[model samples]
Target: MYLLKRRVLQFFTMILLGMLLLVLLYSIDGLIPFLIVIAIAAPLIVGWQILFDQVQPQAKLAWLLAVLFIPFLGALAWVMFGRTPRRHRRVKRTSSEIRMFRQAIEMERIETANAVSDRFPLTRTLQKLGATGADGHTSTKLLVNGEAKFEAVLRDIEQATHHIHVQYYLFRTDDISSKIRDALIKKSNENVTVRFLYDGLGSQEIGEDFIEPLRESRVHVEAFDPVVHPLLVFNANFRNHQKLIVIDGKIAYTGGLNVGDEYLGKEEKLGFWRDTHLRVEGPLVRELQRLFIENWLYAGIEDDKETWDLFANEEHLPEYFIDEPKDSNGATQLLVTSPGKDVTIRDGLMQLMMEAKESIWITTPYLIPPPELLALLEVAGKSGIDVRIVVPGKGDEWFSFHATEYYFEQLLKRNVRIYKYNRHFIHAKTVLIDGKIALVGTANLDFRSMYLNHEMTIAQFETSSVQELHDAFLKDFDESILIDWSILRKKTNGKRFVEAFCHIFSPLL
Candidate 1:
């Protein structure tokens, strides 16, 4: 109810603001300038809609129609209400930078070994998925929930010898966050190069004073993209949703864990938070370090040979996956998609799912997938491929939860196994297929993750990791409740209509 009311209020607010802007333009009293501005803005708005519509054509049709019908008013509504948060420039890598990084890594791959063989049947798949010759010798430990993740991070920080690179979507100033900050400061004081990169929008609530103490201790702290004025909040679209930490270019951490009380189970509203974090120790740490370097550079940190050399230790063999559209050396491909990019990770995942052979296992907190994605799963299930999905019975987003449930009904009818996790909000984003391939990253099975946000996923092929992930899925399945199709079909007509309406906006939601 609160969410519905909020949306209603926001709709009116946007309408009022659009009218004011239109009136202001008309009052300019210069027909030529007004016409010029409209001409320029028209194409810009239309092009934006076309691009987004192509990405999710089905769900975006209504919005596209509304914009076309109303023109000025429609464009304003779309801009003010239709657009999702823009991709933050703070985390975006320029085409040149990405190209350079890919070239440099490709050159590095020439010196690496062909770790893929018949014994590792998934090597070709990995190469296709983007793993290729990017191999690293590393140990990976999965951390379940915030407590375990925090403990592991603290251990790495305490053992840091030379440098520590940290990037996170959110870094709060609460107890756990402060403890980590203090540790970083102490490490910096001891001459350990400590670099902290945080998303400006995600950590905006934390004041400069929170980082002041770290700077005082000589710790290098940088916000990914800092908004200088309140009026520019619209520009806060792009964000660094990646959580990464590299210690002395040897150990690293990734996965969904962020630095906040809610993540740590210290928030009153979200208790016993369930999440996943990976502690990786291997040559792959260098690749993780490289990603941090790229993000640091994007955050305006100067990158030099000295900083690059910290990760130049070639003695350790690390399997690194480079995500490029044209690389063809390996079957394992790394798919990274952002709002600005032509190929999105979400779409890539959908494509992969369409090619599934035996089964598709997906786990995510949010299940508001686009219509096409929902249809793909429905088709896959109808075709007799084992299609299974696990979502939180109770989600952090209430509307999203209901929206997910709405899709589950259709899936259930098609024999897709829909599991509602009652333990806690399952925040992991992973998908395993036919016990041969798996996707692990921050990308959720939703429209926002697919199109609006910048997301990265490591597609592993023919690896034991897939089996492990499958086993984990089965374990989770045991703890979940399978939705009854008959019960769902019995829902009231009005309720079904409401869900159908919500599902229509799944792309925008």
Candidate 2:
């Protein structure tokens, strides 16, 4: 009832404003104002229907309602926030820098990569979607949680040879982060080249004072997508959510765990931070290496000649480490998803699910999915495919938690099994299919990740990697609380109201 009343009132206000504006314009001179309105309004009205083809139906309707009700004001809002315009000079400059920076890392592949693609049709589709291909000669380790991941990272940092490249969305100065920083400083003093990258907006808490020691130690520290103008909020929407660590262009690491004490299960508010991390070797580390360089240069850490300092330093450089594949178990591809890309991480996940004949298991910290994804899962469930999803019982963000809960009933009706990890806040983002292949990375199943942010995911076809992920999923499922109909119906009226309100804007959020 409140929703209806709000809409009714907004519509009336729109009408009143339109009438008042028209009268004021006529009192002065109607000709110019009327002609301008006719030209703009006529095209906007017709072209909006065409624009609907580009966006999702719900998002399209939201844009339509704003335009019809608010008229002139709505048009301004649409231009500002409704579209992802890439015409801005800053955007063009950033793109050019990325192209220039990307040239530093190796991208060639061996023969086995092509063979893997031909053998698996889905990998071909994923390649077309993400502009990535499989690297057959590679090794992987499925790290279960943050503690395991950080321990491995610290050990690897201590053993660094030629160079080290590390990036994270969140870079806190907590105990864990401080320890890692000290290790990097130790490496820098050893004359082994080192570069560290962080997202500006996500790691806003890290001050210049925090990073001063690294700079003084001669370590190249930079931030991606830094806020250029205070008035420009749109730039803030696009974030570098990718967490990557590459050692000497051979060893690589990625997953949900960022550098922080909380991630190591040391924060009291969240008892344990359940997550996953992967350590990869072989041709694919170069892919992660390429992404790190792309961001390091784009962040304007430096410009002009000698732009490839991160990749190359002629003076006092150690030989690049040769991290051969521990075993050629199967193929792995490092798939990158970002704004202005060919397709997306979401597309790859959907294609992966289409190949599932036995079961589809998923886990993520957030669950704000678009309608098409919701429909696909419903259909898959009806077809008797084993469909299961694991999410956090308690989320770090309150609004995100309710927005995820909002889709429960719709999914329940279609027989999709939903489980909430009750022991702690689980942040592992993964997709496993048929016990043969898996996806693990930083992209969460939400609008921000799918449509706006820059993210990464590794498609693993290795039997060992897939088996480990499958076993982990089963363990998490065993410890989870299944969300059946009765439990959902027991929600209080106040909680229901809050969730309902949050659901209305979940897509835009």
Candidate 3:
């Protein structure tokens, strides 16, 4: 209903704007020639660009259709959303910083090369896509829900001796967010350096009341691609969806849970938030710290002195770089993906699916998988590998949920099992393969995560974390209702039509 209303409003607004454009053109003398030229040239130029663009076929087709049918508005929309802006300066600076850590990373790679290659075959491919390979001697604890993750994170923040780095897609003004803010303020008073970053669009509701306190305490804060800043205006499609926190360059956390009351199951509309987060210690923490600092730099922090201060000094680099404990057998790699960059997370997921021997189990809130990934899932299921997906029984977004439903028939035909979490919104994004390797991250199994937003995933191989995720999936299965094709066929024709309509917008969704 909400989506329908929004679309109707948009349609009427576009119609009014088009009418006004015509009125203005007619009021001017000899403007018909200019209008004719625009009508002829706009679609052709945009269509040519769409054809040659790097977007997926589905998205390209969607754009082409929009241009052909709704020429003026579609061309304007294309100019705003379709063009992928290059981050050349940000990438160059980030690459240089990453290079400074390579000497230490290369030394460790020499020691763990055999273990990484033998255990995780996808690590090398991920490395080529600009992600660091597996880091051995890392200890991991699977945080089962928002409660556990917050407890661990708060405790870590309190114990921070050096500095605390934090970022979230959504930072709400609620009990949990307040607690975190107060903790960080106390730490800042104790002389701990605190840097906080949040997505401007995702946390747009965070007003001055929530941020003024932090600013007063001297905690460095910035918004990633602020929605209404002079440098950027309403960048709705491209988002920084990374949820990360690193403490003292030793411990780090990342996963599906953002800093919000809804994430804590306090949002009554979506009860019992089922999510997954990972707490890690060892070399992986350094990688996470590197990512956070690089993102901090990209978030408009340009002062060379300020950036160098965050890394401490060259003499103390070994403490942040070479410190290893050999605490667990987990070999973990962090994979990041952004628009105009290789889809590291998607490619890594496909590789894992192809290598699956026994089962491929996935849980995500959104299920609009890319065409290639959808095909891979079908193939894996047809090959007799156990393929199961768990999605939300109650989604917060209307169009995305219906768009997910549209893919059910195709997957059902391939023998893949689908389960809707009946008890709560299952927001965890995970993939467990062969009961050995697992991926836990903020990236959903959808086109946006693959091609539009910035995303990160933790690929763990030969770890107890995989078994923990396997057990969690089993528990989730017990709480979910298995979906069947026969049941889907019983839906009303109106419902089916709505789903089909929603699916048409999946590329944009």
Per-prediction TM-score to the true structure, in the order listed: 0.79, 0.83, 0.90
In the range 466-491, model 3's lDDT, one tens digit per residue, is 88998999999999999996789799
Candidate 1 to native Cα RMSD, angstroms: 5.9
10 residues in a row with least lDDT, candidate 2: 1-10
Question: What TM-score number comes out for model 2?
Answer: 0.83
What is the alpha-carbon lDDT for the whole of candidate 2? 0.75
Q: How close to the true structure is residue 255 of candidate 2, measured as C-alpha lDDT?
A: 89
1-509: candidate 2 lDDT, tens digit per residue: 01223234444654575577677666767476775676478548644652754655666666666667665756544553456523343455567666544443232333235577766667677777764667677788899998789889999989987788889888899888889999999999999888888887677678888899999998988777665432333455467889999887778999888889988788887788889999888867766766776676667634533254434343312233243665667778777777643346888888878778988899988888877677788888888889899999887776778889888888888888999998779999899988888999998888767876788999888547888999999999999999999999899999889999878767655
Worst 10 residues of 1 by lDDT: 322-331
Tens-digit lDDT string for candidate 1 (1-509): 01244445555665676677677677767765876588468746764765654455754675676666666555655554445454445233444454455555554441234554454444344445433243424445657678888998998899988788888877888999999999899999999988888876667667878989988987777777675642333444345677888887667787777788888767775566667666666445555666777666556634423233233334322322322222122223345555544344655676678778899998888888766788898999999999999888676765676678788777887989988886766888888888776777777787667666656666655444566677778888998888786668688988787778767666666
Question: Candidate 3, clashing residue pairs?
Answer: none
Instruction: Give the runs in model 2 whose Cα sits over 4 Å from its true position.
Output: 1-54, 63-114, 228-232, 301-306, 309-323
What is candidate 2's CA lDDT for residue 148?
89
Candidates 2 and 3 compared: the better one by TM-score is: 3
> What's the lDDT for residue 466 in model 2?
86
